[model samples]
Target: MGPFVRRYAMPLTFLGLFAAVWMVQALVLPPDARRAVIAWASTNLENLAVNPVGTMVASAFVAEGAQGVLLVVAAIGLFPVTRRFGNLRAVVLVAASHVLGTLISQGIALVRLQAGLLSESIRTIPDVGPSYVLCAALVAAFLYGHGRVRRLLALAGWCALVPVLLDGLLALEVAAVGHLVAMLAGGLIGGLLLLLERRRVAVPEKMAAEPVAGA
Candidate 1:
């Protein structure tokens, strides 16, 4: 695929899926059905314990109201990474960020509960959205982002996202805390990937320079 298409394919796919789901939610599903769908797609500690894999993937594709709009904007920021690294990495980065973010945040909640900082009722709080993965990828793209424009766009996203995360943390919301943790995870993962890429290239060069074992 061409560079432009390679970069855009994943985001386009996401947008297409988003449109389909939006329509389904708006036109087809009844209010109760819609609520049921949202519940099914949620990836809270309770839900993850039951259907860990399902909620992770399902949550990514399910966006509602303002979240859908925010997701589209985040996807736009993520396109540069997709173009540079291809779709597979884009998906992996987002998925890892969301999953790991969920795990860590939930873990924190558990600790808080044990310490009496949080209530047992909080354990079942439904947490679903693209914020974790979206923040991670967008920040990662910025970290490894090529060119001034792409980096700036990444920065713009950071400015917008970080405040929300901070607000969430300040408000003692698990979901917001998860988003912040996930964003950091994304940045760390992006940095590690860059290092790994460098090492990968260097290893081949080192091998070429080394004498053959048989020789």
Candidate 2:
């Protein structure tokens, strides 16, 4: 197509792959099987820790792995580089970040797995850790460095985590409404910050032609 199309193609493609994989896992894997797999992986090799041995689980694991690798590529894409470098960066960033996020997520999952093994009902608590670090890296590298696209994707990404955490909190019998409210609160704060950040980033050359200005 055009330069604009080419610029985003790699990112879009990897994202699609990542989504497909996660969707398969979420749609296919059984809860019990998923727990068992997580248990095995936690006590043994980190590599083996993926639970839920169904087709969907396989798809999700592969997708998460791909995302981890792609994240690093995306980070490198932030630097001043040739067109090839931009594409290369996109791939690496997506994969690397996904891996980091997975590792963080696994750490949290391990606790639940242990609970399962012990016949306890305890589950893991939510906090910003390795997974957040991975996500932060992806966002910072893209928004803080390259400063592109109004950072909506970054903000939305964080917001998405809220819903997942809300579901977890609800399962734990915490104030379910609180979790939802927390998401709303976070949404507001995150939105404001992104808006401020968007103000500071240079309007890229490619964006200059727009009739309506983009933040």
Candidate 3:
């Protein structure tokens, strides 16, 4: 148990936090209050302008729809990435993807609004959810997961998520754009991490082999 916890601490902690927030949203808050909280936490343009970092970070932890299903999807995506990259790198990969996805999608919305292509209401549209993070993790894991089981889990996750995340991508809908960006960003970052990991291992092996070669 201890070894497992240490190995998968990032995913475990994330799921725990997600579960707690889900419980609060579902059980503790009434409909009105829940809506209020979700709005406040959303990464909408209004909130992003006022408090970018807070909203961006908060929005990733708050989600809607079927909680159990989301949790399972999150677990399937996150665990493989964490196991392959370790906790810190996995967190960096997902968090960076989330932030990039949100900023790019919202930035485009802002540009369209300014150019009269989008409505003013988009500034306050509720956009809170963990979909970006999950999308990113799924991409990274699918591309770079260590073994067959982990890779299959990621593939399954992608299949389940693609319809939901890519629904409005052609229309440049904010959520869909964000999810797409997150997936691309995650794949790129994961590739970089893989290269770095290989280089690190190669360097040490080369150094160790030098003495033997000289002898």
TM-score of each model, in listed order: 0.86, 0.36, 0.96
Worst 10 residues of 3 by lDDT: 206-215
lDDT of 1 by residue, 1-215 (tens): 68666567787777677667778988999998988888888776678779989988888767656755566667655786676566877777777888888888888888788899987787566566677877887788788877878878877877876776668687657877788888888888777777877898999999999999998
Superposition TM-score, candidate 2 onto the true structure: 0.36
Model 3: lDDT equals 0.93
Q: Best candidate, lDDT-wise? A: 3
Q: Which should have the higher TM-score, number 1 or number 3?
A: 3
Model 3 Cα lDDT, one tens digit per residue, 16-77 = 99899999998999999988888999999999999999998889888766778889989999
Output candidate 1 Cα RMSD.
2.7
Tell me how many clashing residue pairs each candidate has.
1, 26, 0
Return the top candidate by TM-score. Answer: 3
TM-score of 3: 0.96
Name the regions of candidate 2 deviating beyond 4 angstroms.
Answer: 15-85, 111-138, 145-149, 160-215
Taking every candidate in turn, the Cα RMSD to the unseen true structure, in Å, is 2.7, 12.7, 1.4
Q: What does the lDDT read for residue 151 in candidate 2?
A: 48
Stronger candidate by lDDT (1 vs 3): 3
